[model samples]
Target chain A: MASGIAFGVVYLVYQPFNAWITEVFKGPALPVTIVTFIFCIVVSLLTPPSTHTEEERVALVMAERNQEKTASVR
Target chain B: MVSGQYAVLFVIGFFVYIGLMILIAYMTSKKGTTQGEDYLMGGRNVGLLLLICTAAATAVGTGTSVGATANGFRDGWLGAVYPLANAIGLVTVAFCFSHVRKHKFRTLCEELQFYYDGSPYMRKFMSVVIFIVSIVWVGSAINGGANYLAYLIGMDMIPAKIITVLAFGVYVFVGGYMAVVWTDAIQAVLLFGGFVTIAILAIPAAGGFDNIRAAYEAAGNPGAMTAFGVGSKGVLGVLAVALASYYGAMAGPTAHMRVYTAKSPQTARKAILIAAAVVGCFSILPAIVGMSGFTIASNTGAESVLANPDFTFAYMATTVFPPAIGLVCLIAGLSAIMSSADSDAIAGVTTFLTDVYALIFKKPVEDKDIPKYSRIILVIMLVGAFGMTIFANDIMSYINNVIGSFTPGMAVALLVGRFWKRTT
Candidate 1:
């Protein structure tokens, strides 16, 4: 969010920063997305894991089993 | 007198094709369950054939017809990289996420909700993002279609834009998902056949590959004949263009909509794989056609083709082919544009109703009213996109770079959210 606003909104539009950004990153869109994905990981690591992790695992198992059952029934 | 006669024939063929599509939409509505799951996801019983056709048809749209042709005109074979990258996305979906059909997900938003441990924030955010992407995509498709029409028919832009919208909108309005799939199935054959035919004819018409090469060499663009766009666009430029298209394909909502509608996970996987194979096989056809257009324009100084290279396919089809073949090929190009436009338009309408409309209205729409509201929103969405298309002279710049600016954020989020456990 910050990088999107900073680069896509603010930095890329301004002259010196935009020129500097071009010198470094070439185009900001793809690089900023990579940055955003890293932020997802880094921010998540810095925060607590969701409590529903185990339930989510079971939900996948259930989905597989339900699919199998549906296949068999059909 | 000869060209005028063909022009009249082209007009008649165009109306007949559009009328046929609308008729197919009406027929499908009369027979099928146009309510609830059926309306949205084609009753969740789409088989391999329907899925393959719809998936391929949607993937091969505006980009292949207009934008990639423009890219090919400018960058040579770098345009082939796009369909190839899109094929990779389709293959990845087949292997990695086809099982999502088993979950019976309707929107990518719902898929996000499932992936993010029922988190509402990502879903809500994705709704807004997908909605915007949908509108932008439809706008781009309309832009391409309208330009192609205006150039070929010699009509003013606004009326051409309206016809472009109605070409797909009326059917999608009446018949919903099945209408899109069935019409797309028929169009898939035409688009593929037409593209391949034009490419084959265009090479000889441009005085053969050797002549094209000589023309480019003489014109000082020997690089446009190269394999990877390495000579024309630097390695970094190629990589950047390829990357922008790739992730967008992996997370494209219309493709996911196909997955959701497939009869089973296995069926979805197979359909997507086949579509990938089909798209991969046809990747280079646009390059041939576009390069042919470039050759013709460069040699003859066709003012219109030179002025707007986005109309490369149009110029090639209408001017290069015989009258009857040209009409068929032009309809095929229209098929490519309409296939994607209608699917994206439907995807946008679905996102709006499920996410934004529900959030504001305090209740899910009654199943019966889905079609009604979908029609209303569909009009509003197309009109909004029509406004965007009129000001844009170049389809590739607005549709490609403009869409490139916004879509990657949500695409990356979806990839991470599903693949990584720490999304929350």
Candidate 2:
């Protein structure tokens, strides 16, 4: 959700300051298309991983199974 | 008159498209589990060739070709910029495809939901928006086919509207993703063949490339000679902007969905790269055709510029080329139109089924329910599209506007999700 909020702010900022961005940036001026394109690339780079690490996922499953075994033994 | 020749081409192309559609449905129907996932997403096993052809066919629709032709007509070679933007987007997707498909998520909303799971409500919200946008996309697609039939047969649009809706409903309803992908592959080849043929015939008729080049100079549309010729006031500047815009929006729903459909991430990426090259390479044909229109108009002093840009390509083919070649051009135009609409209709319905029904309902909508619901939504969307076709006199305007508005936000979403590892 922080990412969404961050993007919302960025959207507003980009809209107002879009004309100045291309000039401020190194390459072509921030024509709407270029700015939006760069924005997508930058945000995609920021997105978090969707899945758990293999070690972590396996560890959690193993732990739960062991607890079940212990309970059965008792 | 070229009318008789165009009729022959239409009959031939129509039957050819129909035959290929049936063949694909038969071949892939055996792939097992015609569920929501398999039917809509090609069972997540799409290979490089099918992915490339489907992406290119869907993205480079009649809107792209016809609009570019019109742009070429009004502004010289300046129209090619749109396809260039589209190509850039395709290449960007090629690079991003592997990472996106890594998650094994069925829908793009799932990708978003993965990252923003903290706000469960937000995930639901975004999914709804995405689903609606996908549905809206069906409008332009059906309109494209309806418009094409009107141009080719000189028939009233009522019959054409029925044809567009029913054809989309029937084939897409039965075949699903496998059908959309394989048929699009065949259609893309025909589209390329048709466009290239018209362009080759037009060059000589316009007194060869040299004469065509001379006509641009004569009209004082000199920028048409340059790579940046597609935009008038901001040529090179617009090209750069368009390239960046293309990169951001390259993997919009249709292309992004294909990423998930691919056999593997590598397959997805390779397909996108190939599609990028294909779109860039084939884009020149319509520009050539547009220039031919300008040349013919210059010599004949005809005012053929109508309310839509698609007419520029159609007019040039039927008017300038010999009857046979002209027929080929119509076939190509129809191929591009139908290929795009069919794939889009399938994708749109898939999104509706997966994103809205499956997700929001928060229950497993049995495997058998998928094809049934998909066909139902497809029929509904096509009916809606028929309405849009009737109202949309300037279909190109809506085409450009819709892309301009929807894609940038989605691009931002994709960027943050892919690079930041936000989902972790």
Candidate 3:
């Protein structure tokens, strides 16, 4: 949600856009959400998984697959 | 048609309708839900119909109904964009987060921590943000309900705000989340019926669909007749509104709570899908209702309506519909606001009691004390939020600001943390 918060801060900070700018991009939120979303991923790739996160991912994915398999079988 | 002439009827009708909701809440609940699960999640056994109704009702809330009506007044068919966004959000939730129910998370924070592999930093920081977002959302709901009430009854905003908060507050305190879902079901019926009834009656009242187009073009807002809003809010503007809505819906504390409240993963997923379809249909009503209000306003040159289009929903109801029909219609408008408010309030209180309060004081709340603490926190938070509403300029702005300010950080965090592994 940092994307939203950052947009809010920018929106509250000033009306930076002319009418054309706002009409075109909706005041930086799209770009912000896109940027932060990507930024988080890049930063994440640079770091290690949280302790046991891989294990958590394994269980989570397993449960999801099992549920799908159960549904299909039934 | 004058508001003062119908004040008594409106008051009586509103209270009676509130009474019906309370009755529904009482009947649906069992011995007032003393258990934490029952109080917080309606025993997490919410059936499909109840889940769909509550989810739709919550999704509609102030922004989708009152705010959209106001939007429709100015922008025409573009008002449908708001509910359209909600539909998208619900569908996304159903698919992306369908498996969350299996984990049985009490708060989004727990899910966050799990996503981060038991990391406590994000959870501790985001809890306070989640609680504040709930208050801001409830605050906006109060503001939304009060806006229409003030115009409909010619009452001061302070009194209107108090009535709006208390109307939902009492029942929620008594019956907890069960009451919220039950009341929401009743409200979903009224909210749809009222908007549709007004839309049906209003088209003819304003002379017809052709007249609506003619009047809008005559007012120099040719964009008002088009779905994409050609004027100031063009295609991109509409998309901006949708993106903001999607973000809010994805991370809204109350929406998260409801997802967890569902009986199962399949049920939650199905309920949200149904809610999306229902809201998709409901979007058209506001487009018609708001356009009708604009048609009437342009014809009559009602300065009150022109100056404050937010009041157009109630203004149209009070002036256009017959007295009895109008009274129920206005209550439904208030219900649209309260459905969201009460759930968010309960969700906030439960989160605070279970997450924040426990985190602060270093112990889980006693099982016996959960009910008492929940009520106390609800009162405190509502009062604080009520105070905030008195100063808000408009429901749309209040909702957008409050939601936009806090939700993106958590929403992005959840997406990144849950789906990605290397986040330590």
Q: Each model's C-alpha lDDT?
A: 0.78, 0.65, 0.77
Sorted by lDDT, highest first, which candidate order results?
A: 1, 3, 2
Clashing pairs in 1: B38-B43
Residues B304-388, candidate 3, lDDT per residue (tens digit)?
A: 8888888878888888889878876787788899889998898888778766875688666766777788889999998888877
lDDT of 1 by residue, A1-74 (tens): 33333445444347786677566655555676877777777877897776565445336333332222212221
State which candidate has the highest lDDT. 1
User: B284-344, model 2: which lDDT tens digit per residue?
Assistant: 7767778777777777776544445467777776777776777667767776777777766
Sort candidate 2 into its docking category: incorrect
TM-score of model 3's chain A, to 2 decimals?
A: 0.44
Candidate 2 A-chain TM?
A: 0.27
Residue pairs clashing, model 3: A1-B408, A1-B409, A1-B410, A1-B411, A1-B412, A2-B408, A2-B409, A4-B408
> Which runs in model 2 stand beyond 4 Å of their true positions?
A1-74, B30-36, B117-119, B240-249, B306-308, B358-360, B391-403, B422-424
In every candidate, what fraction of the native interface contacts is reproduced? 0.22, 0.13, 0.46
Model 3, residue B326: what's the lDDT?
85
Q: Between prediction 2 and prediction 3, which has the larger lDDT? A: 3
Ranking by DockQ: 3, 1, 2
Error of 3 at A11 (Å): 3.2
